[model samples]
Target: MQHIIDMISNGTKMNESEHDELINEVSAELVELYEIEYDPDNLIPADDETANRILEAAFDLLEAVGVYSVDTKSVFTIPRDEIFRSVQNSQRYLNIGEGSDKYLLTLAGSSEKKKTSIMGGPNASPVTPEMFIPIHRSYAKYTDIDSIAPAYLDVPAGSAKKGPANLMKARQAVQLVKEACALEGRPDMCITTPPHIEDPVAAVSVANPRFMGSGDLQEIIPQQGLKVNYSELSRVYHYKMTGSNYLCSPMLVRGLSAATPEQFAIEIAAEALKSQVVYGASVFFKYPAHIHTGDPLKTLWASFAATQALSKNEICLQGSVVTSSAGPCTEMMFYETAVQTIGYVVCGCDILSGPVSNNGSITNQVSGLDAHFMAEVSRFASDLSLKDANYLCNELFSRYESKLNAPEIGKPFVDCYDMNTIEPTQEYWKLYETVIADIYYILQQKNRRISRR
Candidate 1:
């Protein structure tokens, strides 16, 4: 870990333009080296050859360009040999929570029959202090979710992004999640994430053992397409120094930073490699979001390719979240979640981290019910073959592909769920049941076809 810190402080210095140029140049070279091609039809490949090629491509990218340090204006390069050694020596499983609630989260593979652990919350969605406890309590009350990520307090009095005020709010958010978990009779439930605070002091301060439990997972998010800033790096350093568990999250944009699907896959694999070699994190979570189209298929395709690569080659635990274009109470939202969840699980993800409704845009637009569905789908897909899982994804994607662009904004939490009872309203419940039934019907049909074959 000290080696990582040293590299962060003292690495090859480069300007932003030079960094970008390096990425573009190396990425282009890797595409040719690997003979990478985008297949819109086979979003999730079942074979080992594709996965191996992607893993190798990622290694080449790391050896060629290294990770750019946005804070130090430098690049940290790891030798290919060291990168392989780190991955070979990486941790394969993480034990989270405590006592009876404790869960063993291991690396998932396309062929593995193990159920992935579910992490639920609003995913740092906006919530007033008043709504924070009740909203989180609702999520904790669900028996299916293995962990929780609480919503950030969108305080009305002051800015929630800086200074002592932000620190106070960040601490408050962490305490509120603990309180909510205790209230729901699951005090040991693994809590994930502090509030999305920007102040480095506040961010690092909230991750201490006094506030965050040892079993809980903190986060270190690099910027899109293999860039790490000081703020996130400091948080990871704090967690490591304090002996806490942390997850490395990296996002890849489909066309913006990644340029193409092949590039997107390469970047995610590279980030996953860096998570172990540089960040020293055991769990890696990454997602790809499309820049132009609201359709998540392209994003899902790129992510599935990358995750399959990592799942096959690395020992570290891996996962991705279910982030839909539409908000809750819409069929599109459920459809999107099913597709994303199935893709991630079948391609090899150890944890199911979300159902970030409304693309995590609007405040109070998330629900425990959607997260519940994500968990259920994850468990169901755990035993499925990659071909069957791909079939289900294709079926669900066809249902809502056209609706992606004009997704319904839907209602906020107050309108769809009863805060007093901490349960979804009758209308929302009906939608939930209807969507579940529709999916089961598709699965039933799929099974029938398989039997006939």
Candidate 2:
């Protein structure tokens, strides 16, 4: 810790620093992430040894770049040996939540565990306080969804009710979700996030200090990409102070920072490992691309390689079914979710389904049925092996990869789900049923292939 201070005192950046430094603020990540030291695109290695190489490479990148802290405008210049030791010392498994709702979280690819723990909710889509309760009910009612994440409050800066507090939304966020939990009779469902992790102190201020007693998950997101600000660090401190279960994943954009699919795997693998080492994350979430549903095959292969890198560590990783163009209700939305879900399941990783209805730029566009149908397909897909999974992924991607740009953003939640009853309407139910049945046929075909083999 002293060395970090000294390095910060001396300053890590040679140039005058910017306020928001994402992972590799310089835009050129020092590690190319090639295990074979060849082009990752054509010569990708599917073996455990390759994963090892990527892990080492990521560590080397961390060592060389030294993480930058935008809040302090300083670089964290720790020795590589010390960094590794810190990571090695972090706790591996975190048993979270109160009695009935407790979650046993492990590092990504931690073991040959069955049934990936479901953490379902809208992926922080914009939501009014009134709609929030019903939205959460949609997830809590599902048998498979074990945890719930709150939707982002449509609350804007200078909320009329809460005065000028930076965290007014945070407080409202906690209350809204808690209300929904009670309404659903699943008061114990572990909540990993409350809309945003941007303000850790404000985020934690709403908590009952006995977060340990309740066993809910609290997250800390390092600023930019892997860089830590005062806010992220404060959250980490609070997590330890409360003895709460911790989850962190410093995301990496595959297209922006990493030029190819293989680099995406290496960056995410390294980032996930960094979270474990740095944040003591029992499990971390890694996003494949900002392109969302744009490149299904590319994202799948990227997630596959990333999971392979973390598998050796027996770490648990949470992946998302992010969409580029597809939104709720449309067949495109269902198709994209299935392809992304298959990638994670076939790779043997858990899921954080649905932020499904938006391009990276669009907002306020997600719904319940996306997750409703996704969890069903994911459960069935989880039964397949990597070979069969990959074959299925290829077949599924062929359906929608071409239309990711101008996909039909389907109807809002109110239209498909009766806002009054919070149940799916007949039209939406049929849409979900059709997708599930289509996937079942695919699974049957997978079985036939296995028998033939």
lDDT of each: 0.80, 0.62
Winning model by TM-score:
1
Error of 2 at 289 (Å): 4.1
Checking candidate 1 for backbone clashes, the offending pairs are none
Q: Tell me the tens digit of each residue's lDDT in model 2 across 1-453.
A: 334445556765533244223434322344443433323232223356666766776666666556666656666655677767766665555565556666675654523655666667775677777677777787777756767766777755555432336466676677777777778777776776665545455667655543313467666655434465556656666766766666675545666555556556666765765675556665677655465444545656666666666655654455554554677777777887777676566565655546446653334456656776767777777676665666666667667767766677777767768877778888878988887787778878878977999
Model 1 regions more than 4 Å off: 5-10, 157-160, 290-295, 447-453
TM-score of each: 0.94, 0.85
lDDT of 1: 0.80
Error of 2 at 107 (Å): 4.0
Q: Which residue segments of model 2 deviate by more than 4 Å? A: 1-7, 16-46, 108-111, 156-164, 210-213, 293-296, 315-324, 351-355, 359-364, 446-453
Which 10 residues in a row give candidate 1 its minimum summed lDDT?
287-296
Q: Considering every candidate listed, which one attains the maximal lDDT?
A: 1
